[model samples]
Target: MDELITVRFFGMVAEKLGKQELVLENPGNSDRLLEHLNENYPDLKEIKFSLAVNKKLCTEPSIIPIGAEVAILPPFSGG
Candidate 1:
């Protein structure tokens, strides 16, 4: 069975992906998720972004449970 993961994009990342939210299947971890995103959304590879899982910011290769909400946040710019 495939797992469902929710991905939310912010700022330029969202713009690049052309959406604020997306649903991905069988995302085992941040690593797999990144690979899937980069494959489907090639532009994602060119940008700098942070990964958040279940509202907590996480480094790559982190575990991603089923139904987890993953966020792609663009680099922050200070005013």
Candidate 2:
């Protein structure tokens, strides 16, 4: 059986994609996931975002285990 990844989009990212969440075939790593997203959603390339794996922010490409939950977040601001 193939592994799956759950992706959650936030803020403008969700608005652009028109959905808040998606389930995709696991790409194995963050880099591959980004590539897939860019190919499938070209508009995402024009937007800046961050990735969090299993609720933890990732600064670099990281391995994605089976059934991982990934969150795409737009830039945040503070008052």
Candidate 3:
């Protein structure tokens, strides 16, 4: 098995995921990671959010090393 990475979700995604953080086997890179997530949580495909790898916003999937910190930020909505 590959190393494990942690993905954090904020706002709506977090609510849907039902947690703030998740530990998953590093799926090679960020793109694969998203695929894993989408497979695990098919609902994510329709959600609008910014993905970050190691605290940096990323549109492309990045390689997730062991213990990497990834985050998902949902579109912000305010009054």
Candidate 4:
């Protein structure tokens, strides 16, 4: 059996990808996952976004546990 990662896109990120969620093979870490996504979805590189692993914000390269839920979040604005 192969491990999988669940990715959820929010706001503009989802608009760019044309979907809100996806399941993919585990990419080992956050950096690898972002690389893979950028390679496959060039539009992603056009906008700034953040990564959250298992609902926690990941500011740097972090291990992605198998079956983890990752979210691609667009910049947020609050007043």
Q: What is the C-alpha lDDT of each candidate?
A: 0.87, 0.94, 0.84, 0.94
Model 2 regions more than 4 Å off: 77-79
CA RMSD for every model?
1.9, 1.7, 1.9, 1.6
Across residues 1-79, which tens digit of lDDT does each residue of candidate 1 receive?
Answer: 2478889999999887789998878568898888888889999889998999999999656998988899998996878
Q: How do the residues 1-79 of candidate 3 rate in per-residue lDDT, one tens digit apiece?
A: 3477888999999998898999887777877877788999988988998888888888675777777888999987887
Best by TM-score: 4
- Measured on C-alpha atoms, candidate 1 has an lDDT of 0.87
User: Candidate 4 has which clashing residue pairs, if any?
Assistant: none
- Per-candidate TM-scores read 0.89, 0.92, 0.87, 0.92
Give the clashing residue pairs of candidate 2, or none: none
Question: Which run of 10 residues does model 1 get worst, by summed lDDT?
Answer: 1-10
In model 1, which regions exceed 4 Å deviation?
none
Off by over 4 Å in 3: none
lDDT of model 1 at position 48: 93
Q: Rank the candidates by lDDT, best first.
A: 4, 2, 1, 3
